[model samples]
Target chain A: MRKISAEKIIAVISRLCIQSNCQINEDLITSLKHARGKEQGRARMVLASILKNIKIAQREKLPVCQDTGMAIVFLEIGDKLKIDLGEFLSLSALVQEGVRRGYQSGYLRKSIVEPLSRVNTEDNTPAIIREKIVAGNRLKIKLLIKGFGAENMAKTSMLRPDAGEAGIKRFTLDSVKKAGSHPCPPMVIGIGIGGTMQKAVSLAEEALLEPVKSKRAYFRGCPGLKSKIKRLEEELLREINQLNIGPAGLGGETTALSVKIKTFPTHIAGLPVAVNISCWANRHQEIIL
Target chain B: MKTKRIFAPLTSEGIKKLETGDEVLLSGIIYTARDAAHQRMTKNLKKLPFDLKGQIIYYTGPTPPSPGKIIGSCGPTTSYRMDPYTPSLLKLGLKGTIGKGERSQEVKEAIKRYSAVYFIAFGGCGALYSQFIKKTTLIAYLDLGCESILKLEVEDFPLLVGIDACGRDIYQQQKT
Candidate 1:
C-alpha cells in the first residue's frame, strides 16, 4: 500500500485552490483567442478585455474573477492507496481545511453562504467533494472553482427515452437561448446525458473540467461511443455559437467557446439530461500523486 | 466606436447626451454595492451611507486586496439582481449604475423617468478592472465583508452605455 500523508494532501489542496482561481489554463486561453479572432464590434472588445484580465491575474497573482467560487474537489483514489489521516477525522476534513487556508491566504472571496439564513461562511469551507476509487495506486485530485453567475443558469431535464439526441439538442439550445447574456457569453457548455437526474448533473459538472475540444479516451462503452460523443460535442458547439448571443451577449458569431458532453447508461425507460454553463473563466486544475 | 470620456457625479445634460452603444471612459468617484448592501440600503432608506444624488453604484463584490494593492479583482456583477432596488435609487437622483447583463423593462422605464443612465463594465474582466480603481474606502455595512459599501475612486474605467437617460437600451438594440 502506498501511504500518502495527510499534511501532503492538505498542502496540495490548499495550493490548488489558490492556483486554479488565479491561473487561466492554456487550453481555455487558446479557445478564447480563437473566439476573439472570430468576433467583431462589442464582442471583439469584450474578448480583448477578457484576454488582458487573464494576463493581469497571472502577473499579479490575483484571482481571474472576483467570484473566487465554491470549490468543487474531485478525488480519484487508487484501491491500493491509503491516506494517513493525522489528527483529522476524515479525508474531507483535510480537504476543507485546505480550502479554508487557501481562500484566506489567497485573498479569494468567501462566497458560500447558508442557503436560508444567507449568512456568509467566512472562510469558504465545506467544499463539494466527489470521490471515486480507481484501479491504480495513484491519487488524483481535481479542483473546479465554480462561480455562481453561470451556475445559476444550469438546468436538468428527464426526457423520454424515445426523445434521444434530438431532445438533448433542443433542450440545450433552448437553455442557452433563454440564458441570453446572464451567464456571461462565450461560455463553455457542459452536457450530461443518461444516468439518474443527479448523476447526470454531476456528469455535466465533470464535463466542464475537460479541456476544450479534447477527447477523453477513458470512457468505457461501445467501440464507437467515444467518437459519437465527440461528434455531438462538435455539433453542439456549432449550434450554440450560431445563437449569436456573442461575447458578453452583445451580438457576434462566437457565443460559446466549446460544448462538452459526458454520457452514462441509464434505465431503458428514462433519459436524463443536464446542462451546466461555465463562464469564459472556466477555472479548474488537477494534480496526481 | 469613438470613446467618450466622462466623469462620475454625472450631470443630467451629460447623461441625456449618451446614447445606447456609446463607449465611455469614466473617471472620478463611484460607490460599490452588491446584493446585500442593496437590500440593506433599500430596506432602510432613512439611514443611507451617503447621498444618492448624482452618484453611481457599481454592482460588484470584489475579492479582498492582496498586500499593497488598492483592491482585488473587481468587476461588475450581473445588473439584474439589483433591478428590484434600482428604480428607488434612481428616483432618489442616483445618476447612473455600472454593472453587466440586461435590466428589466421596469428598470429601463425608471431610468427614463428619473433621467439616469446604466453602463456595463466588461463582465468577468475583474483583474483588468482592478487597474482602473485608484482607491477604495469602506463606506458602510462593514459586516458584509466584500459586499460592504465602498467609495471607489476610479480612473479611465472602460464602460459601454447600456441604457441611457432616454430609455434607449443597447441590449435591445443589439438583439435585433
Candidate 2:
C-alpha cells in the first residue's frame, strides 16, 4: 500500500483553492481569445473587457469573480493508496479541513451556509467531494470553484426512451434560451447523458473539468460510439452559440464557448440528461500525487 | 448609447434621463446587499441602519480583504435571486440597484413605477470593479459574513443602464 500524509492533502487543496480562484485556466483563456475574434459590437467590447479583467486579476492574484463559489473536489484514489492523518478518521474530514484552511488562508469569501437556518459557515468548509477508487497507486484531485450564477441556471430532465437524440438537443436548446442573460453568457456547457438522474448530474459536473473541446477516450476502442458522441457535442456547441445571448447577454454571435458531454450506462427505461453551465471565468485546477 | 457621469442621491430627473444601453460612471456612496441582507432588510426595513431614500444598492458579496487593502474583489451578484424582495425595497424610495444579469418583468415594472433605474457592472470582473471602490464600511447584518450590508464610497464606477425608469430595458432589446 502507498501511504500519503493527509497534511500534504491539506496543503495541496489549500493551494489549489487559491490558484483556481485567482487564475483563469489556460484552456478557457484560449477559448475566450478565439471567441473575441468571432464576436462583434457590444459583445466584442464585452469580451475585450473580460480579457482585460483576467489580466488584472492575474497580476494582483485576486479572484476573477466576487462569488468565489462553492468548492467541489473530485478525488480519484487508487485502491492501494492510504492516508495517514491525526484527528481525521475519514477522507472526508481531511477534505473539509483542507477546504477550511484554504478558504480562510486564501482570503476567499465564506459562501457555504446552513441551508434552512441561513447561517454562514465562515470557512467555506464541507466541500462537495466525489471520490472514486481506480487501479493505480497514484491519487488525482480536481478542484472546481462553481460560482452560483451559472450553477443556478443548471437544468436536468429524465427523458423517455423514445425522446432520443433530437429530444435531448431540443431540451438543451430550450434551457439556453430560457437562461438567456442570467447565467453569464458566453457559457461553457457541461452535459451528462444517460445513467440515473443523480448519476447524470454528477457526470455533468465532472465533465466541466475536462479541457474545452477535448474528447473522452473511454469509448476510443469503439470508434463508432466515440465518433457519434463527438458529433453530438459539436452540434450542441454550434446550436448554443447561435442563441446570440453574447457576453453578459448583450447580444452577439458567440453565446457559448464549448459544450462537453459525458455519458454513462442507464436502465433500459430511463434516459436522464443534465446540463451544468459554467460562466466564461471557468475556474478549476488539478493536483496529482 | 453614450457614457454618462452621475453622482448618487439620484434625482427623479436624473433617473428619467438614463436609458437602456447607456454607459455610466457612477460616483458617491452606494450600499451593498446580497441574498441574506436583502431578505433581512425586506423583512425588517425599519431595522436598517441606513436610509433607503434615494440610495443605490449594489448586489454584491465580496471576498474578504487581503491585508492592507481597503476592500477585496467586489462585484455584482445575479439580480434575479433578489427579485422577490426588490419591489418592496423600490417602494421604499431606493433610487437604483447595480447588479449583473436581467431583472424579472416585475422588477422592470417596479423600476418604472418607482422611477428607479437598474445598472449592471461587468459580470465576473470583480477585481477590475474593486479598483473603483474608495472605501467600504460594514453597515449591518454582521453575522451574515460576506452577505452583510456594506456601505461603499466609489468614484467612476463603470456600469450599463440595463433598465431605465421610462421602462426601457437593454436585456429585452437584446432578445429581439
Candidate 3:
C-alpha cells in the first residue's frame, strides 16, 4: 500500500483555498475576453470592469470577489492507497483544519452562519467534500470556491419520462430566463440530466469542473445518445445567450459563456435535471498526486 | 448615460434629478451592513447604534483587511436578501442604498414614498471597489464579524442608479 500523509492533504487544501480565491481561472478570463469582444455598450463595460477587477485581485493577492465562497472539495482516492493520519481522526477533520487555517490566514470572510442561532462560524470549515475510490494508486484533489450569488440561482426539476428533448430544453431555458442577471451573467451553466435528484445535482457540479473550452466526445457505438447530448448542450448555450440578460444583466448578446451537460442512467420512471450556474469568477483547480 | 458626482446624506431634490441607468461617482460616508446585521437591526430598531437619518446603507459583507490596509475585498451582496429590512430602514429617513440585483415591488414603493434612490455597484468587482473605499470603521454589531455595520469613507465610488426616487428601475427596463 502506498502511504500518504494526511497532513499533506491538509496543507494542500489550505493553499488551494487561498489560491483559488485569489487567482481567477485562465479559462474564465479568456471566455470573458471573448464575450467582451461580442458585447456592446453597458455589457462591454461590465465585462471590462470584471476583467479589470480580476487583474487587480491577482496582482495584489486578494480575492477576486468579496464572497470568497464556500470551499467545495472533490477527492478521488485510489483503493490501493492508505493514509498516514498519525493523530488525525478522519480525512474530513484534516480538510476542515486546512479550511480553518486558510480562511483565517487568507483573511477570507467567514460566511457560514448557524441556521438556528444565526451566529457566524468564524472559520469557513467543514467544507462540502465529495470523495470517491478510483482505480489508480494516485489521489487527485479538486477544489472549487463557489460564490453564492450564482449558486443561489441553481434549479432542479423532475420531468415526466415522456417529456423528451423539447421539454428538457424548455425547462433549461425557463430556468435561465427566471434567473436573468441575478446569477451574475455572463454565466457558465452546468446541466445534469438523468440520475436521482441528488445525483443529478452533483453531476451538474461535476460538469462545471470541466474546463470551459474542453471538447465533448461521442460515445463510440451510441450515436443516438451522443447526438442527443451534444445537441442539448449546443441548443441550451444558444438559447440562454439569446435571453439578453447580458453581462451584469444590463442587456446584450453575450449572456452565457458556455453550457456544459453531464448525464447518467436513472430510474425508469424519473427524469431529473439540475442546472448549476457559475459566475465569471469560475474558480476551480485540480491536483493529482 | 449622464455621469454625476454626489456625496452621502443625499437630499431628496438631488435624488429626484437622478434617473435609472445614470452613472454616478459617489463620495463621502456610507454605512455597510449585510444579512446578520440587518436581521438584528430590524428586530431591535430602536437600539440601532448609528442614526439612519439622511444616511445610505450599503448591502455588503467585506473580507477582513490585510495588515496596513483600510479594508479587504469590499463589494455588494445580493440586495433581495435585505428587502424585508429595507422598508423599515427607509421609514427612518434613510435616503439612499447601494447594492446589486433587483428589489421587490414593496421596496420600490418605499423608494418612491420615502424619496430614496437605490444604486448598484458592480457585483463581483470587490477588489476594484476596495480601491474606492478610503477608510472603514466598525460602527455596530462587531460580534457579527464581516456582517457588522461599518462606517466607510469613500471617494469616487462608481455606481449605477438602479432605481430612482420616481420608481423608475433600470433592472425592470432591461428585463422588459
Candidate 4:
C-alpha cells in the first residue's frame, strides 16, 4: 500500500482551492469563444463582454466571475493506496481552511450557511466531497466551484422506457427555457442519462467536469453504451442551442455553450435523465497525483 | 414605449415615465440590500438604522473588493429570492427595486398598489454595474458578513423596468 501524509493532501488541495477559485478553465473559454461566434446581436455582444471580463479576471487572478461557487470536490482513490481516514479529514479540514483564507485573503464573499436559518458560516469551509474507489494506486482530486445561478436551475426526470431521445431533448430544452435568464448564460449543459434517477444526476455532475465539446464529453466516454450515446448527445446539443434562447435569453441566438451527455445502464423500465448546468464562468480545476 | 431616469426617493413623475421595455439610465443615490438585509430592515422599518422610505434598493450583496477597489463585481442577485421581504418594504413606500429576473405575483401587485417599479439591471453584468457605483459605504448588518447593507452612490446606472406600477409586467407584456 502506498502511504501518504495528511499534510501533503491538505497542502495540495489548499493550493488548488486558492488557484481554482479564480481561474476559468481554458477549454471552457475556448468553447465560449466558439459559441460567441455563432451568437447573434445582443447575445453575441454580451458573450463578448463576458469573455473579455473572464480574461481580465484571469490576468488579475480575481475569482473568474463572482458567485465564487459551492466547492464540490471529487476524489478518486486507488484501493492500493492506504491512508488513515482520520488523517484524510484532517487534511480535508483545510479545504474550508483554504477557502476561508482564499476568500478573506482576496476579499471574496463567505458563502456557506446554515441551510434553513440561512446564517453565514463566516468562513467558507466544510467543502463537499464525493469519494470513489478505483483500480490504481494514484490519488486524483478535482474541484468544481459550482455557482448557485446554475445549481438552482438543475433538473432531473425519470423517463418512461418509451420516452426515447425525443423526450430527452424536449425535457432538456424545456429546462433551459424555463430557466430563462436565471442561470446566467451562456450555459454549459451537463446531462446525465440512464442509470437510476439519482445515479443519472450524479453522472450529470461528473459529466460537467469533462472537456467541452470533446469527442470525449463528460458522458461521451462512458464505456459499454458510449458509442450509442455519442450520437444522441450531438443531436441533443444541436437542437437545444438552436432554440435561440440566446445568451442570457435576451433573444438572439446561442443559448448553450456545449451540451455534454453522460449515461449508464439501468433497469429496463427506467430511462432517467438529469441535467447540471454551469454558468458562463464555468470555474473548475483538478489535480491528480 | 416608456423611458424614465428616476433617482432615490422616487417621485410620481419619475415613475410615470417608465415603460416595460424602455432602456433607462438611472442616477443619484440607491441603497444596496440583498435578501437577508431586506428581511432585517423590514422587520424593524420603524427602528431601522437608515430610513428606506422612497429610496431605491439594488438587490445585491457584493463581494468585498480586492486591494484598491471600492467593490468587487457588484451585480444584482436574483430578485425573486427577495419576494417575501419586498412587499412589506413597498408598503412602507420603498421607491423601487433594481435587479434581474422575474418577480413574484405578490411583488408585482405590490408594485401596482404602491406605484413602485421593478427595474432589471442585466444579470451577470457585474463589471458594468460596478462602473456606475461611484462610492460604497457599509451601512448596517456589519455582522451579517457579505450579506450586510451597503449604501452606494451611483451615477447613471442603466436598467429596464421589469414591472410597472399599473400592474403591467414587462416580462409578461413583452412575451407577446
Please provide TM-scores computed only on chain A for all of the candidate models, following their numbering. Answer: 0.97, 0.97, 0.96, 0.90
Which regions of candidate 2 fall more than 4 Å away from where they truly are?
A217-223
Q: Candidate 1: TM of chain A?
A: 0.97
List model 3's recovered fraction of native interface contacts, to 2 decimals. 0.73
TM-score of each: 0.98, 0.97, 0.97, 0.88
Question: Compared with the true structure, what per-residue lDDT tens digits does model 2 show for residues A1-289?
Answer: 8999989998999999999999998888888899899887789888888888899888877888887899999999998887788778988999999889988998898899889997778899779999999998888999999998999889999999889999999999998888888877888888888889998898888878889858662342344877788899899888887887889999987888888888888889989999999988888999899
Candidates 3 and 4, the one with greater DockQ? 3
- Give the Cα-based TM-score of candidate 4 against the true structure: 0.88
lDDT for predicted candidate 4 compared with the true structure: 0.75
List the lowest-lDDT window of 10 residues for candidate 2 chain B.
Answer: B40-49
Please write out the lDDT profile of model 3 over residues A1-289, one tens digit for every residue: 8989978888888888899888877888998998889888899999999999999998877888899998999999999988887678888888788888889899888888777997778898669999999987888999998999899999999999988778889988998887776777788888888889998899899888878887772233344887777777888888888888888888898888888888888788989999999887778988987
Give the docking tier of candidate 3.
medium
Compose the digit string of candidate 4's lDDT tens values, residues A27-66.
8778778877876655676677677666655665555555
Model 2 lDDT per residue over B1-101, tens place: 56899999788888878888998999999999988888888878777778899999999999988998888889888899999999999999999999988
Each candidate: how many clashes? 0, 0, 0, 2
Q: For residues B131-165, what per-residue lDDT tens digits would candidate 4 score against the true structure?
A: 67789988889978778888888887877777887
DockQ of each: 0.84, 0.83, 0.80, 0.40
DockQ score, prediction 1: 0.84
Per-residue lDDT over B41-142 for candidate 3, one digit per residue giving the tens place of the 0 to 100 score: 999889887999989999889999999888999888889989999999999999898988888999999999999999998788999999999989897888
What's the true lDDT of residue B102 in model 2? Answer: 87
Prediction 1 global C-alpha lDDT: 0.91
Best by TM-score: 1
lDDT of each: 0.91, 0.88, 0.87, 0.75
